[model samples]
Target: ESGVGKELVAKNIHNSSDRAEGPFIPINCGAIPETMLETELFGHEKGSFTGAYAKKLGLLEIASNGTLFLDEISELSQRLQGKLLRVIETESFFRVGGLREIKVDVRFVAATNRDIKKDVETGEFRPDLYYRIGALTLRIPPLRERREDIPLLVDHIIQSKPEFKHKKLSGKAMEILTNYAWPGNVRELQNVIYRALFLSSGSTIEPHDLSPDLTSGLTVSGRRLEDIEKDHILKVFREVNGQKRKAAEILGVDPKTLYRKLHRYGIDD
Candidate 1:
């Protein structure tokens, strides 16, 4: 649900709507700290707080006459949720420390992988705000449910990568990808393609070039997570030609951590 390309859907709607000319502002409610969420959404005046050096526009004002996409909407604290409800009702909100209420004409689009009903039932989410945001709900099926799109999505991802423009997935590789349960969804698929591209010896990427982690989900089919990690490290080692720095980046870790893992895994690289 997290990596089901929900942002892409939001963007497509914005681009096709009458507000296409306006900015499509997207905010990840869960990513920002709760303390800063207010200022980030409504903006703060110069000297509003310690770091407010100049008058700044909030995302609501920025998306005036446009679309404001609040991703991970359920993550918004109750206070922020109440404030957001007021904005939806009045179409105007004040800056964090500003007295004046700024008016904006913007459409709101919210998304969350969490179950809003359950959250609201548990009092974690406000009913008033929930109804406001959930006026129209569209469910996006997971990648496992829509395997038909994998090849097309794979092609889209591969061709977009300049280095893999000429690369193609071998039949066995495609079979493996098709059969595996993508717990991480499209995002995981993209990573696998990138990893395959890195390890590919020719224009065609084979099954062995792909990360074993793809199969790590199914206990009966794939190796354990540790083995997947080991194979992944070895593949990355070969891909970067022993460049620890680059390999670390590709693996999403610091050089020191990468070094320690390599040592722990008994990898020379």
Candidate 2:
């Protein structure tokens, strides 16, 4: 789900909106440590803490009149979630250890790879905050589900990179890419293409240029356990058109086991 390009979608929304002229700021909540995340989002005032040298502006202020993309927002702790909910409800927040409340007109776009609703139900996420951000939701399917977009995406990636300007994917290579179960989604495809570009001797990328794990079916000696299982299950699931029972039968596993695995892998249906 991560490599599905949620941030890209968020940036597109921001660019297409009235705030296109304004700055589009992005932050990964899960990437930053919890201790620093609060300061990063709300900033700090001079003398607020040991390292607070000057009045620092938070993303909330910097993204004023624009969009603040909160990627992996589900990773926010409950305390941070409450603080964020308050700001969302009031459109204002105070700088860390500051007396004055700073206000900003910011469009929030949140993304997560987890089932946030389930998180809320399980009490891991706040329900009120969920409703606030859930006013609109968009689901981007994994690459394997929408194989039609592979060629276009491949072309886009190729054209975007100057080094690969004259390079092209061979028909067989494209076929292998189109049929393979992309467990890593678009990000993986991008990496594979980039690797092929570098390893390719000529202007064309061939099937053999792809990584062995991606091309070879005879061996799984070097592949990660989860990756192999994910690929096999996804292949069977797709073959059965997402019929869990049939897939379970083919996989020699129970329907519930198959369902649990699919859910764990973030596969829809």
lDDT of each: 0.88, 0.90
Q: How do the residues 1-269 of candidate 2 rate in per-residue lDDT, one tens digit apiece?
A: 86999988999999999999999999999999986999989999999999889988899999999999999999999999999999999999999998999887999999999999999999999999999999999999998789889999999988988967999999988878877778889999899888888899999999889987678872344345897799889898889998888889999998888889889998955
TM-score for each candidate, following the candidate numbering: 0.77, 0.79
Candidate 1 structure quality by residue, lDDT tens digits, 55-116: 98888988999999999999999999999999999989999889998888999999999988
Model 2: how far is 120 from its true place, Å?
Answer: 0.6
Model 1 stretches astray by more than 4 angstroms: 215-269
**Error in Å for residue 97 of model 2:** 0.8
RMSD for each of the candidates: 15.3, 9.6
For model 1 the local lDDT of residue 183 reads 79
